[model samples]
Target chain A: LAKTTQPISMDSYEGQEVNITCSHNNIATNDYITWYQQFPSQGPRFIIQGYKTKVTNEVASLFIPADRKSSTLSLPRVSLSDTAVYYCLVVENDMRFGAGTRLTVKP
Target chain B: GAGVSQSPSNKVTEKGKDVELRCDPISGHTALYWYRQSLGQGLEFLIYFQGNSAPDKSGLPSDRFSAERTGGSVSTLTIQRTQQEDSAVYLCASSLTPRGGPSYEQYFGPGTRLTVT
Candidate 1:
């Protein structure tokens, strides 16, 4: 498992775009970058995943640089309901979660 | 379709007691995982079961913690001699498969909140 580092917290307003970055300097070749969102009293939900380059889905977009040392999660037109804790994980088999980045979407 | 379901959403027990938490994974999912989440903290992996293969128990914190998946569909995490430090939310997740790839997306249950007094 690769250790990940992310901001402790972030703040944004409604209808704004929020981007959270995660750093995994020692990522392995087989490791994939996955993002999950967790709301109050709920389990984390998968948002997006990527091995390299960029991957986009109905909810969010994941951008992995060429070096694969870091990745970014882009959320467009965020709303108050988007407030949650975002986790960036680099996993091969075992999934180890870090403290995560808390995004507070204000109204 | 149901994602994942856990039983006994909340449990309060005394120290030195034993407790069991159950998890029902999505139909046909081959990979099931157990995790522990403390208040204001991140998730800690506990155990994993993939199909009929031997479960990976390396993440278990102690001998008191044990889990078993029967028929590859349901799982139960048992803790013996629970202590106050065992008070936390226990979560269960399932995925289509356990292969290390981008397609492995884990669906989590609401979790069981255990409070050991």
Candidate 2:
């Protein structure tokens, strides 16, 4: 399992774009980068996933470099309800969670 | 027509007693997983079950914590002689399959909050 490192917390104003980056220096070739959002007292929800380059969805966008050592999750036009803990995981069937980035969207 | 479901959304038990947490996965999902989440903490993998075969119990914290999946659908996580440290949210997730093919997302249940006093 690849260990992930991300900021403990980030603050952004409403309507602003937010980007959370995760570093996984030991990422394997077979690993896939996945991002999940979790709110208080709720389960984590899958936001987006990508293997390389850029993958965009209605919710968020994932940017993976060619080295695959790190990835970034971009949330466009953030709202107050978008405040939550964002987790970046390098997955390969084995599940391991790092301390996720707590994103706080201010109004 | 349904997502994963867990019963007894909350449980408060006394130390040295036993407790059982249940999880009902989505129909036809062949892979199930159990994880523990402490207050303000990340998920801790407990076990994984695929189909009717034996589960991968390597993530179990101790011998006191055990889980079983029946008929490849529902699962029960049992904690014997529970300790105060067992207080946390027990979450259950299910995926389409665990093999190395194209992977589907893992859907999670609301989880059962266990408090051992």
Candidate 3:
């Protein structure tokens, strides 16, 4: 199991690409980096997951280096609805979500 | 087409009373998880179930907290003798089981808000 660290908050303008990074120095083998989004008053939902390199989906993109020590979640053209808490999860034996980075998309 | 669903969107119970929260996972999903979130706090994993395997209860706060996934679709989380500290939002998620384990993209339901007085 690995502990993750992410920024507490981030501010971005609409139409901007927002990237939030998480560090997990102790990431173990077979671990996967997963990102989740949680809107206010709702449960958290998975947005994306990756093992290494880059993985992109309709909602977001994830980038991981060969070292596998950190990963970044990229949200392109973020809108007001994209404002929420973004959780970075490193799943090895079990899944654990960090405190997450609260992203605020401003007009 | 339907996402995960939970019942009793809001529950208010007195201290020492027991409460049961229900979760209905998406059809065909083989994995389900339960979590709790307090005011301004991050989610705390409680338990999870995968197919016919025994549930992972390592995250349960205490013996009073138990959960069961019946027929591998619907899950019920029971909190015995609820206390004021148990007030929080209970969230449920389900995912299509991946090759290694339940690490695939998960769909979530609107959480149930619990207020214990």
Deviation from native of the Cα of residue B6 in model 1, angstroms: 0.4
Q: Per-residue lDDT of A37-68 in model 1, one digit per residue for the tens?
A: 99989999999899999999999999999999
TM-score of chain A by itself in each prediction: 0.97, 0.97, 0.96
Q: Which of the two candidates, 1 or 3, achieves a greater DockQ against the reference?
A: 1
TM-scores of the models, in the given order?
0.98, 0.96, 0.94
How much lDDT does each candidate structure score? 0.95, 0.89, 0.90
Highest-scoring model, lDDT: 1
lDDT of 2 by residue, A46-89 (tens): 89888899999999999999999999999999999999998888
All candidates in order of lDDT, best leading: 1, 3, 2
Model with the higher lDDT, candidate 2 or 3: 3
* Alpha-carbon lDDT of model 3: 0.90
Q: Candidate 1 — which pairs collide?
A: none
- Which 10 successive residues of model 3 chain B have the least lDDT summed? B97-106
List where candidate 2 sits over 4 angstroms from the true fold.
B99-103
- DockQ for every model comes to 0.83, 0.56, 0.56
Model 1 spans with C-alpha error above 4 angstroms: none
CA RMSD per model (angstroms):
0.9, 1.3, 1.6
Give per-residue CA lDDT, model 3, range A10-50, as digits (tens). Answer: 99999999999999999888788888888999988779889
